[model samples]
Target: RVDGEILKGWPTPTGKLEFWSRTLHDWGWPELAIPKYIKSHIHPENLESDQIPLITTFRVPVQIHTRSANSKWLDEIAHTNPLWIHPIDADRVGISKTGDLVRVETELGYFVLKSWITEGIRPGVAACSHHMGRWKPEGHKGQRLGISTVALNQEGSEWSLTPRKGGEPFASSDPDTMRIWWTDLGVHQNLTHAVHPDPISGQHCWHQAVRICPAKEGDRAGDVSVDTGKSQAAYEKWLAMTRSADRYSPDGTRRPYWMLRPVRPERDAYHLPLKTESAEV
Candidate 1:
């Protein structure tokens, strides 16, 4: 059993099976084995129905799959989780640029995040790369270079490095010691995820459609503004449908499932709703 339903054998779900068959048939390919009892659930009516919401997975540059993104060294290479949206969609909602903060909103909820507007995504749909933003304490340590190097000058009997205010030279070695500061710490962008569900799988997609906008004047940099009334309501709706325990088989052991586990219960409130805003680019 999976998701409280029994799967009798090794056949693809009715919906996916039909899609494959139709796709093959339309392309002039051979028809594959499709069980007779399993009705073709893909109908023009269903395709046109409102049941299916936009579905997409996120991708980022620095991380490979889920494993590397969690490593300290790799995280420093790319710090933020950027949302990818098509230019047309971005234009429709007012998203402007790669660095601009944008909000994406759906019926279930909304989130505010930095936008990476491009033509890669399909119009009316957006994507966010998972991994990237990470906040582990040790990870913070890797962000800044601890010690710096400096240049020193030696003139006749006098040798000096740049002096600190109200103090002697920062350091004076046999060869003048100079100091310079450097950093390797990168930004974490994963804080923008919110709880949203896919209608078909009854599983949370963890991404939300939203609008993007500039931080208001005098607003702290990186702070997002969310409508509490809307966010809270959306969260409650998701909570109602989420399963308390992992799905299991009829015999009580865990079922063979292929999906990622939910990270935690935290949502961002700063994103704009898709219908209300346009891409700023």
Candidate 2:
């Protein structure tokens, strides 16, 4: 506090909090400068009649990022990530009961997971808890607690993750390794998720609008199918929404002075002209 008074300031272009962002306006985003209801790509009104919003941002209380997936104590409480669908919506998708297999389809491809019918989530929305699916490629160094070793097959723009061996009882130097029993490690849905980046905030849009349907004949648990071609298209679509740095950096600087930098570079290094020339080699 300055002189024991309350001090209030924010990290905006303005010294104080900004009601309208001048930086956004000057970057050719005048429409987004003011705070108002901007419709998301998957907004309810914008969604097609058959589509349901898939909320991918929810996290289980016990886990923190992907690291805690290897924690035996945490995995015991919450291990599997079932697709949470309301009973009404579950019926529409032919999911009769909890634990039934369901395929959630995105623009790129699909992932099969168990169904969880409940009134806990909204009727028209489906949610899969974040950070449950953690896998390691076969022959790669991996943790034993909560990760499964898998074989990754790639053909052109398509990728698939198949389980090689799940966590099982085995003789090891550590006695606790034999005590491990649970094997229902969740599937990695993030692999199939197409990136939808926010133009202004520069954040990947996590919420998706997906088609919920019954699992196909060959679909298995923990299976992820992705066509990288569609993923690349989604990335380019969002990238085009953003103003080009080459065009906007009239002052020769890459970004605004107030923007946070982890390690501040030399002043001359911030100039794009000099930086571009050095990269030519």
Question: What residue pairs clash in candidate 2, if any at all?
Answer: none
**10 residues in a row with least lDDT, candidate 1:** 160-169
N/CA/C clash count, model 1: 40
lDDT of 1 by residue, 6-118 (tens): 76743433423353453223222333323243222222242333222233355666676546633444544554555676777666666666767664444432334566788
For residue 270, model 2's alpha carbon misses the true position, in angstroms, by 3.2
Off by over 4 Å in 2: 1-8, 274-281
lDDT of 2 by residue, 99-212 (tens): 998999988989988898999998999999877778888888857677888889999999888877766766677776688787878888887788988887688899888999
Residue 97 lDDT in candidate 2? 95
For residue 33, model 1's alpha carbon misses the true position, in angstroms, by: 18
lDDT of each: 0.41, 0.83
User: What's the true lDDT of residue 76 in model 1?
Assistant: 42
